[model samples]
Target chain A: MDINWQFIISTLPLYQKAAWITIKLGFWGTLLSLVIGLVCSIILYFRIKVLKELVEIYVELSRNTPLLIQLFFLYFGLTKLGITMSETTCAIIGLAFLGGSYMSEAFRSGIEAVSKTQIESGLSIGLSQMQLIRYVILPQAFAVTMPSLAANCIFLFKETSIVGAIAIAELMHVTQDVIGMYYQTFESLFMLVAAYLIIILPLSFLLTWLERKVRYAEFGN
Target chain B: MQNLGINVLFEGTTLQRLFEGLMMTAGIAFISIIIGSFLGIGMGLLRTSKSRIVQFICRLYLEVFRIIPILVWLFIVYFGVTNALDIHLDGEVVAVIVFSLWGAAEMGDIVRGALESLPKHQVESGKAIGLSFWGLYRYVLIPQAVRRMLPGAINLSTRMVKTTSLVVMIGVIDVVKVGQQIIERSIIKVPTASFWVYGLIFILYFIICYPLSKLSKKLEAKWEN
Candidate 1:
């Protein structure tokens, strides 16, 4: 194979920095998605008639639309409204929003998995609504959400590559820039693939760790 | 651009644009299912093979295909992976290849699930009737398994159509890309109504996918009966 060992060696540090950006966006995106999703899913779990329908519509619309369109729309549309920032932040925010929408459904399903009997049990305790959810409910729901959230994290990590279109200095963006500068298009992209592997392979192991730790009746061993 | 009532839906050449994209989308969706189904059946059975090595390969195929997001997969196949493999191919060809692999994995799992859902008694009776393996599958097993698999397979097909939009990221110019291009054009010509273009896209996707989603749900209910 015709390889460029020298170029990769020289750019390894730059790639490392880019990797940091990728990791940060993915981690933050997953966090935001989980938090926001969990909050919105309360309406769905409570089955609050009109609110449930509205959240369902929100979830479906978000799921059906592609992340890229949403990114571009928010990017350009917000800029026109005088909201501007570094492209990296904008891209990460977009990733978070998109991932958050999907995460809502995940949380909703997880909450529903908690069994209505648990709700009756909580009511039997005569605890306040807020106290019941805090003490009796959310812990079990979060446990069930682990395996799914793992799969989603890996996907979100790869999705950071889309930010390259908007010229963020992440791995994929640097990849394209490197190719353009050196004209070693294939080599640059191959390096990016290897870069992705280095980034994701560790996270995959971590996911397995979390999933195993959660080890409940519902999820896999 | 033409205007009709308060509903800007069917007006201007928007209907024509949507029609063209809808046909392409449906054409790809239907064709991919036909292709993915056969491949999925083979892979699904291959996964159930007694040989450990064959099972390992099936698992590896599913893992790699599943872990990577479809958009990234499309980019790599159409651009990076193809370049590395040194195979020159068009965007659509690459899209179909990647999508088929994805569809195959999902379909294979669905096939496996449906096959497993069947009771052992039915198979035992087929064997008691002195039917051969192929005879049992062709006459008894496949029909019932196919019924159970229909809803999921159709749902996956609808998903395949929705996912065809990812082809646009690699520059295939499907409905989404065409919408983006039109929006850009409209931005220059008529800056007053950008929402119209996005709303058009949302409607177009609905027109294409909503019916499929409903049909799949209906098929599921019917199959259950």
Candidate 2:
């Protein structure tokens, strides 16, 4: 019946430490996924013969299955193949693979959004394939995909909580541990919610701003 | 192959247990999606309401649910709130409630987008015909909105199905949880149990979700046409 503000306040330091870990996981996860997604999208855009189908299958499998199961497969199934990694490494890799699938879809759409005429024009100017991609395709695609990329980043941030299931000592994991020690379930969860909102809300605002800026740059204010 | 031992999947009770878990997963996702659609429609209409206070409340609901991860929300309901209130609800009940809450927020956004995208003159024409607010929505708005909203709502349904896998964290005995248990129990007897068990779980989810996602894409393309 009684709420404990004092207890919640006192636990802020512990939660803050966990929050830092979450942010780190999210940062590295998003970065890794973004690179993977970019490569996959570029490969698909160029229509690489054999690897294209393989990449499509990878994306479909990751997209279709649950992240938890994917995490489990990497964490548990990999052990059968004699591949061992720490919980944190597995969590980061799992998140990257999961986020990469979605990111590749977003980037594919972005690349497709670039007009065919642009590439043709670049070719007519004697541009190499690489030059055409660098000069004519990627910039515009980056602008088009920025919003979705930002949204994916936020999704990855929230997904860091799932790492807790694998005992990665992320935000949710630490909060659960704190609850086990003190039994302040309500207070701890309330603080956890606040911690996530604090990170996400500002990130969302920044994304919106960046989206607008990109739009303006593309079209003029 | 010899080192892996005989497959235990088709052995006595293992298949039945996995089937039950699969059914539980389907049942929870189905119930939550249906219930969440209704709640979402209500919230979505509220979001587009003319009243400022109603709109603010709707925005608050969407923002809070969207910001927090569903796992955290599930934990709050299953562990935190229940503990505080001294209620002993079943894990399935908690999963349904948590998933429904998530589905509603997502579907509400879909509905709001669909409704808002309508031409303003359609509503003006309804008002010009001297129709009441209820008549306007029933006769003028909802019919068109439903068509536009179908693909998005279905997409949300697919997402809910995938997201429900998190219920294993709360001990829901869903397919993932069952797989976890099977692997844990079979480790001594079959060293490769986790590979088969988790692989089967992945396939089960892929079967359920891949078709729905494909259907969603088809519906989206159809609508686009």
Candidate 3:
């Protein structure tokens, strides 16, 4: 296939702009899930009966269903219920919700990775439970969770592109828009793939570094 | 529309609907696994290649597929390539292509893990026995590696089945779409309730997915012995 160099370059600016939106969506969605997943994990870990049960049902339900359905139920179904918002908001919420389910599982495993005996020892030192968790338990759990957490971050980054289905001006959506406008479909899409790689590959490298650093500091069991 | 006893799912057009949906879901899944397994094995070998360039390329492929969301992949194959070619592809065929791409990346990782887990002595012994590379892989190395890989393959195959539901976004009319269609139509036919139809769809998915997940687990355990 003859490569049309100028067509691909001209399309680069459009994809670059779209890449920013994908990054923005990933950042906000991951931030929301970080909080929700942490809280849900804490509640579940503590054996808080009502909260734990609620988290269990939520996790199971969300994880089992396709994220597309979850997005549809949230974006389309909720709009019918008079819950209106911008496309960006819908994308962020759906992504965060799905990520939260997976993140909760990741968090739970991390907590389990932290030995119970260590937690008991911290408590037996007469420290309050809060101090025990903050000082002893969470640090180790967080370190253990770094690799999987990074993987999840990358996952959410890719998922943000799915918002294009609902017409958010994310990377994939904007690429499609350009393709439609220009009709240089091959060039536009090749640029899209290149655009995605630039953002995502760097993040993957960053995560690998972070994972190694965490492992070195904590010395994982 | 006739209810035989306690809302018989397998009755008349409803029976046909359920069967068709189930068939489509299974069809997409089987197609993905068959295509994906070959691609996966190819990618996995690429990943473990001694050549740094091939290894780097495989890593690039793995990273792109691993990180990118499945829906986005679905959109790309279903929307991007098809639109580029200006050809209207069948939803099921497109779904298979999309999922096989995803599944192959995942399967490559699994096979790589199995290969890595193998003892060095096993390979050494094969080479020491004067077997050619192909003969060694065929007769000795692969037999054992395949056993290690099967459970993980089973796990991913189940995921591939459930993931066919996502193809509904492109209007494949899989069970998920069928349910959505029924739910939408039910508003006029049975104005009293529509959530029930959607709820039924949800349960059908759970019924299919949960059992397969359990089977994957069972295979993992049985093979561990």
Query: What TM-score against the true chain A does chain A of each candidate get?
Result: 0.90, 0.94, 0.94
**What pairs collide in candidate 3?**
none
Q: Which ten residues in a row have the lowest lDDT in candidate 3 chain A?
A: A73-82
lDDT of 1 at A51: 81
* CAPRI tier for the interface of model 3: acceptable
In candidate 3, what are the lDDT values of residues B1-225, reduced to their tens digit? Answer: 323222434334765785588688878989899999999988887777799998888787877777666766766776667876878888888888888888888899988988888899988998999999889878887788898998889878867876777777667878767756655655555432223444455566667666666677687878886
| TM-scores for every predicted model | 0.85, 0.95, 0.82
Off by over 4 Å in 2: A1-6, B2-6
Off by over 4 Å in 1: A77-86, A216-221, B1-15, B18-22, B80-87, B192-194, B214-225
Which number leads on TM-score? 2
Clashes (N, CA, C under 3 Å) per candidate: 0, 0, 0
Better of 1 and 2 by lDDT: 2
Candidate 3 to truth, TM = 0.82
Q: How much lDDT does candidate 3 score?
A: 0.77
lDDT of 3 by residue, A119-201 (tens): 88898889897898788878888898988899889888877866777788878778767756877766766777777778888
Sort the predicted structures by TM-score, highest score first: 2, 1, 3
Which candidate achieves the best DockQ against the true structure? 2
lDDT of each: 0.73, 0.87, 0.77
Comparing to the true complex, what docking class would candidate 1 get?
A: acceptable
